[model samples]
Target: MAHLPQVLVFGPPTIFTQFEPQYSHKYHFLNAWASSLPLDQFLHTHNYEPSSIQAILCAGGGTPVTVHVLSVLSSVKLIVTTSAGLDHIDLLECRRRGIQVAGAGSLFSEEVAEMAVGLLIDAMRKISAADRYVRQRVHSGPWDFPLGSKLGGKRVGIVGLGSIGFEVAKRLEAFGCSIFYNSRKEKPFISYPFYSSVVELAANSNALVICCALTEQTRHIINKEVLLALGKEGVMVNIGRGALVDEKELVRCLIEGEIGGAGLDVFENEPHVPEELFGLDNVVLSPHAAALLKSLPLICVTLWQGI
Candidate 1:
């Protein structure tokens, strides 16, 4: 019997969970969650030789492949993350170690873009609040309809003009939205009005859609100043990582009505949303599932190529 290649799966991601049965026969999987030992100890026990492990399959919400993890897995030649954002993994360390790293790339771009637009529409129109109002029957009168802002003719600012951001812009264009954008550097040949500063973008636009990556520089990028610039009538939508916005400041802004409302899919902490946001009728919240779909064929293709 030929020895099957061993693959260490961290978080096992959703795709792995769905396809494990079919892929199990082709690969020997080392599931970190199933073990009681620390990762280092688990690897030491399972891997008799350092060169035995060659690749690691990491996912969002999984253990980050930090420097310490890289140090222990010296023989690992490749690291594949199930997420498009690489903030969770240490890219600098991987580069220094000469380890090849692969990501999901643009697999979720369209889905996430759709989700961002959906969130924006929901926030502007108070869709979720209306649903709740109908279900609870707590309204005083039949005419107590939840009024919302119009998406058409609204000036929308996009924080990042990457694949996901571009798709968002395209969709918003169909709704007759005036698009403005801010990126690390201005993209060439793109016709959208560019704002070098995020605060300026917020001040000028009726709404801001956050689609930038989370990094040391970008962490809390949408701080009090940016939110304040958005003004009282401004709406905000975030499909990017949670840390990109200052959660505490955002909560305060929402409660005090500094900003109109927000549509949030991610939070500073996973599965632990701020308690105060639960009651706000202006706020629409979703678990970090913007790109969630019934099937994930693109991720499977990326994994196959990476491995």
Candidate 2:
């Protein structure tokens, strides 16, 4: 019998435990959380037998692949992540060491795009707010509820034209919204108007649906200036990442009525949402579970394929 290739992993137990049973037959997973020793001790012990491990699997952005970690795991030739965003990984060090990196590719694109639209409709139509009103016995009459903006004929701006962003555009277009986009560069094949700047995109559209990746250049891409550009009637839906927009500035914008509304699925800090947003009737919040819903099976299958 041959020894299964060792795969190192550092993340939440629930995520790894869920996938372990499905793929344990093909490889030996060295879960850092399950070790009796500390993570550093486990790494050093593994380093003693460098050839014993050559692959790493990271779920979400929980583990930081620092240069120090890469130095410890000297034999790691490949790093696989279940997340589409690579912000947590040390890409420069990976490049310097010639380690291959694999991601989910377009697997989560459709699911994320679907959620972006769902958030948009919920925010614009105040669907959740109305539901809350009915549940609380506040809906004595239909006119008691606040009005919502119509989805049709609204100008929609997509911050990225990647797979997820394109899917968002397609779905929004079918709903009679005019689509525009902003990317690093204007795509040659795309016919929609392209804005080189996010503020420019916000100025032209009634809503800005953020679907861009979080990179050094894109951090706080939607700032106070952009929020002001969005104005009092514009809505924002962020399905990509929370830090893509300045969360602090966003909170202020909402409180001061600088922007109309927001539907946020991701936050700069995971699992911790600002209490200020809790009171806003125009905003809808979703825990970063947009990509991992009833589609857990599909997500797991895609993750296995990526590995």
> What C-alpha lDDT values do all the predictions have?
0.86, 0.84
For every model shown, what is its TM-score relative to the native structure? 0.91, 0.88
How high is the lDDT of residue 154 in model 2?
Answer: 97
Candidate 1, residue 202: CA error in Å? 0.3
| Candidate 1 structure quality by residue, lDDT tens digits, 149-168 | 99999999999999999999
TM-score of 2: 0.88
RMSD of each: 2.5, 3.1
Q: Candidate 2 at 169: error in angstroms?
A: 0.6
In every candidate, how many clashes are there? Answer: 0, 0
Stretches of model 2 off by over 4 angstroms after superposition: 1-3, 12-16, 33-38, 41-53, 138-143, 296-299, 302-307
